[model samples]
Target chain A: EAGVVQSPRYKIIEKKQPVAFWCNPISGHNTLYWYRQNLGQGPELLIRYENEEAVDDSQLPKDRFSAERLKGVDSTLKIQPAELGDSAVYLCASNERGRNGELFFGEGSRLTVL
Target chain B: AQSVTQPDIHITVSEGASLELRCNYSYGATPYLFWYVQSPGQGLQLLLKYFSGDTLVQGIKGFEAEFKRSQSSFNLRKPSVHWSDAAEYFCAAFNAGKSTFGDGTTLTVKP
Candidate 1:
């Protein structure tokens, strides 16, 4: 089975532009997560979804960030009027129900806000 | 809130030499620990995990980690490093269905 999949491995846009990232979790996985990794740092949780419901999203920057995991399979993360600080790698990960905290991650989308 | 810390930002070792990366965590509950490796332009890959039982757990790519509850640490080790082992390694602690990762240690294997 394929691992989690993410699109647009790399992206470049000017500050104040809108950007979106897409991800398709592994088949049959019930949990999905979005994380942001800055240069030289480990990934930080942005949001988490259990099926169609977003279980945890308190870490997400509501001012410009939004995310959805429709149908509990695929997910999308968007940033409107992106700022230079938003430039980072957006990672998507998934886990099977009842699994012991093992998360399969995608290659990640690297966004550069100029 | 639970958190993980990797004191070393980077490490260098000669190929075929033994290697170890330290990881420390702070959590209120029994910690589910993990080690992940990430190559350039690649996704995070699980090396090994420690949930319960034996303190020492072996993982993929000849990696192993020892969990010490007393120290609140789960340090990764390899008997002999290979050039391909050069990558960023992250130590994580899982809690409440979420995992917290450290800053990551970049390993460089010298020829």
Candidate 2:
């Protein structure tokens, strides 16, 4: 079984530019999550999806950050007019339903906003 | 609000020595606990988890963790350290369908 997969392992953009990251979760997984990790810090949950429904997105920056999982298998996280502070690693993880602790993560997409 | 804390920012241990990483969590109810390791340029990998029953849980790569309800702590340990053990370790807690992660601890192994 392959682990979660993410695209654009690294991205560099100037401030005010738009950026997007994509993720493909493990097969048969019912839950997907997007997280952001700053330098020297652990990953913080930005959004979570159970199937096609977003069960949690309280921490997401609604003003500039948006995410969607149309068919529940893949997800996209977009940041429009990204600021310098938006530079960080965006990680995607997935797990089966009722299994909250066993998460499989992807290599993550590193974004640099200058 | 549930939260996880890793008191140590970094730790260095010599190879073949024992190792311990501290973690603490805050939650009203019993939250699911986990430990994950992330190598440089790699994704997070589950080291161990504690849901119920046993307080001590063993995981891959010779890792083990002890969950203490009284202390609200779940600490990771290894009997013998290896150079490959150098990586960033994160402690996480899941509660009420939400998850929280600590600031992570970077471990360095000295040969």
TM-score, structure 2 vs. true: 0.98
Global local distance difference test of model 2 = 0.95
Candidate 2 lDDT by residue in tens digits, A4-105:
999999999999999999999999999999999999999988999999999989999999999999998999999998999999999999999989667899
lDDT of 2 at B37: 98
TM per model?
0.98, 0.98
lDDT of 2 by residue, B1-111 (tens): 678999999999999999999999989997999999999999999998999999999999999999999999999999999999999999999887877889999999999
What 10-residue stretch in candidate 2 chain B is worst by lDDT? B92-101
lDDT of 1 by residue, A12-94 (tens): 99999999999999999999999999999999999989998999999999999999977888999999989999999999999
For model 1 the interface RMSD, in Å, equals: 0.8
Estimate candidate 1's RMSD in Å.
0.8
